[model samples]
Target: MRRLLSTTLGQILAIIGCSSVATFLLFIVLLSYFGSPPAPPWPWQNAYRVAGLVESLRGAPQDVRNTIVAAVRRPDLSVRLTSSPSACSRQTLDTHDFDAALRAELPGITDLAVRACTSHKPGETIQVLVPLDGQTLEILTDRTSGEPGRFTGPFYSALIFLCVGVAAMSAWAISRVIRPLRQLSEQADAFGREMSIAPIEEHGPLEVRRAAHAFNLMQERIMHSVQNRTRMLAAISHDLRTPLTRMRLHIETHRTDIVPDKLIQNIDIMQSMITSALAFLASDTDRETREWLDLGALISTLCDEYAEGGAAIRYDGPEQIRFFCRPEAIRRVLTNLVDNALHFGRTVTVSAKVLDGAIQVDVSDDGPGIPEDRLRDVIEPFVRLDHARNDRPGSMGLGLSIVKEIVQAHNGTLRLINRHPSGLTARVSFS
Candidate 1:
């Protein structure tokens, strides 16, 4: 029953069906109590009642007829003797069978006038008048609507029935409207525990569809973020171990404790990795907040810093290229690309450009480019290219993988292409 009621059609039918049956039951109770409305006194019953009253009056003396009428009179009825028939002021009822049934009981009467009192209030008042030996006898009483009272007949019954119908219809309509939202809530509960569930379907009214669409987007983004963080932790750990291993081996080999230039670079590299990872993880913006920055200025500063370190690097393209992006994350991406290029190639040239509505930056190196077959594998985390670049002091094959992740986080794309003759270029583009 719970499963059935959860559906739209089932709820609608149940509501309407229950209300209808309840109304019918109510009507039955009213009928049994008030004895059928509007047409209460059956023709034979009314005929017998009127016939008995008339026969009693006819047999009683003129003086005692008034006493008999008074004794039999009720609040809903009035029986009196009159000298003229028009004194009752009653209209004839349009029931031929009732008139014939009355005649069948009272055959002695030649002039029979059934006068009915029309009332707009509660019970129906019926008047039956007949001519006697030298007087007129009028019997006035209720025919239908037992006991003269308001809210007792078919009118109130119909009103109650109508209210039931309207209530049922309203309930069904509301259920249909909120059905999608209910599903949304259920999906949210299910996905809250395990985000691997498939996205809920977007449907229903326009506003509801928009809400569902937003939920789907949030679900996808949260799942992607979790997976990305998991990968980042594993990859960063693997990368950090490389430097730690080198430091350990150096510590073991040179027992005299002389820190060489290559050993210092590895320490610096490990420190940089831990610092960058902490900053990325602890950032309030989840990753980093995007803001407008001068791409050319950033690249120029980086190249100048590399040059200051006695590394051959140059900056090309426009002097100022303003772009919107996460400053720290994008800086990391560019730094990784430039470091990788410097390790493999003789000199690194960083270029920036704004074409169409997008920003493009390329870090090109004039050295042996990566092989076509290994280009795809080079982007995987902890995947080192089988080339001479692996001989670099602090290279752990994390540069391109880090660059790829950062680029993707910025809603950008990264591509590695072999330059003509003898070079490689790493291109990053964003709109």
Candidate 2:
């Protein structure tokens, strides 16, 4: 029930409940206003009592009729009682009783009541005329004076029917009021799923329309910025390749002595750096067509190539561990880490572990662990700790930086920790 009340139907019911209570209270007040008598002394019931000084009073015994009349004259009083000594007289007046007696008459009462002013004296036998046929009295008691009063029956009936109609209309009005808001909620969910839901039409109330307009503008701006950045990266990568090709050709024709050999090595390093940088930048902007590749086989091939060249590299993990990744980009990142490990520590250990929806690759070597404060600085582009650089050769300081960038592009994290056996542990996690 609590959950139901939180839904749209419950909102409609809430509005109806409140409105019905208010309307019912108002109807009570209105009925009271209509039932009130015009005169004073407050005719809350059918009868009223007023005291006046005795006028000329009259009285009579039962056998003989006597005459008596009231001395006071008030045009508005429906019945006037005049008292005379020894006799009393009665005469017809107005029809206040018919209206007063309405509450006692349930179901149907179509008569207007008559008022008879009676005159009598105290301590005397009073004689008054009584109708013989009882026809005049009956007609007067049920005359139904003016137009029939409907406040007790038809008026309330109409009010109840009208109120029910209004409640139904109000429910529809509430649904109409919230329809735009529901659409906004659906659009937000779609955006979470695709980040590309079309903006809703600006309609409904002021607040809703403004929200729709703002969302549309934000979507357009994000799409524009992403397109512009991807285009700029593509242009830069295209322009860098021409100069790289020329440098490779120029170094190839004259690289034989030690100086030439060093230049060619530097150029080769520069070419590899450019290629990896381009791959990292292009990964997210243009998703690669994925294929099945044995991760263990890939790692083994690299380790074997380095082993044949006399590097202390070993693949110490599952022989057939397979995973999907952008092959060229991931290869470059792994290659950079393994090369850095072997260069600095002279021995590299490669291992893989699967934990909690992610694959972790740990590359550790028994060189000097990095200083704790310089861990963050080493991942910055072109940043080399002076001590680490002086301890090693062929280190351009870009290897770990490139590794971090490539891991980030795969929506992964890279961490550098000091190994327990006195080496740096580089853990790369791919999800």
Candidate 3:
């Protein structure tokens, strides 16, 4: 479950959902502020009062209005008053005058209780509703006379600038955190495919850096263990071959008429087992012995060898097809297949072809094919389809297992399939 949520799409959805909720709350607050009635000392109304003061003092005899307006327009004032009423209505204002105008313009503003502001002059103060429209007071001034709140447009413009800054910073922070996590996930996938996974840089937060360090350590340990095991197996197999060769020479020189034919057959079986085990051990250690091999020639050679030994085997396909692989491993895999086919079907056919940028080798025999249910099960190590079929005594079922292991080591696959015309087919492919 944690893995599922850690996916890129999942993380994106979570971010979008959270941001959407925040945006919705902001929207609701803005909507309620604009749509609902004003509070008792309405803040918006105070804006209108300042507008009225500026209007009333616009051309006064004292000349104070002109002096104040000129001063307010200077850059130091940092205030902007637009000619348009819609622009001016949104300005933030001084709390004192704003509240006085709010109370005066909107006596019923207490019912909304949205927000409040007030303004005073000596002992007298004005509290009136902020004008929602430029001419609303013009329509209501005859019914209930009062000053309205007003504001310069600069206040709202500054707020817009601040919102834009916040949004950009938020995006930058999110990307900084998510980038390292994305790289980590990609490295994990590459590791799964057995490719070289570059170590993640320990440049993020402490937790992320620690995770990358641990992953690098684990990979080093695994590589060391594999190399150690391969070396040990190679040394043991090499040592045993010398003793086995000496034993064979000694046995050949003996003149033992007392020994029955069955005993001689048993000795041959033992030799075959030792040879198979040695071949596997050698292949495991000498993985770098790859060559540009003609696959068709290899198949034909194995078929001809078996035919010379009285096995009914035939080769098919083109005169040549080539690939890069360990020729010894390929030969061992083909030999295993052909031997199994001859034991079961009496006649075996080997073929090779190049298809879909891959080399395919098929070894098939006309015999009682495996049951459909046991097709996959038969390929497992030492899992002979039948424990009872013993035309050859001391037959172990490691042949197919070796074939599978070799093919897999070369980044290939092996499969057992039922042939349409007759028996079972072992199909192997190398890319």
Give the top-scoring candidate (TM-score): 1
Residues 46-107, candidate 2, lDDT per residue (tens digit)?
A: 22211111111212332222222232232332222223212223322123333343323321
- Give TM per candidate: 0.54, 0.44, 0.43
What are the lDDT figures for the candidates, one per model?
0.74, 0.60, 0.60
As for TM-score, the candidate ahead, 1 or 2, is 1
**Candidate 2 TM-score to native:** 0.44
User: What digit string (tens of lDDT, one per residue) describes model 3 on residues 119-180?
Assistant: 32222222223232232111111102143332225644554445555555665676676677
Span of 10 residues, lowest total lDDT, candidate 1: 31-40
Total backbone clashes of model 3?
Answer: 31
Stretches of candidate 1 off by over 4 Å are 1-179, 236-254, 257-266, 279-294, 322-333, 367-413
Q: Higher TM-score: candidate 1 or 3? A: 1
Q: Would you list the clashing residue pairs of candidate 1?
A: none
Cα deviation in Å at residue 365, candidate 2?
Answer: 2.7
Off by over 4 Å in 3: 1-260, 278-286, 387-392
Expressed as tens digits, the lDDT of each residue in 1-431 for candidate 1 is: 88988876668767777777787678657744522223434566767767888888888888888898788776655677888744335443323344556777888775786655555233335667788777777766555433334345676778676867687777767777778889999999999898799998898889999999999999998997788578768867777788888778877787555658658888888776666555445544334667998888988999999999999999988888888888887777888898888878889889889899788999999988888988888886546665734554434455676677778877889998999998999999987
Off by over 4 Å in 2: 1-105, 110-273, 276-286, 289-293, 322-329, 355-358, 390-398, 405-412, 420-422
RMSD of each: 11.6, 13.8, 15.1
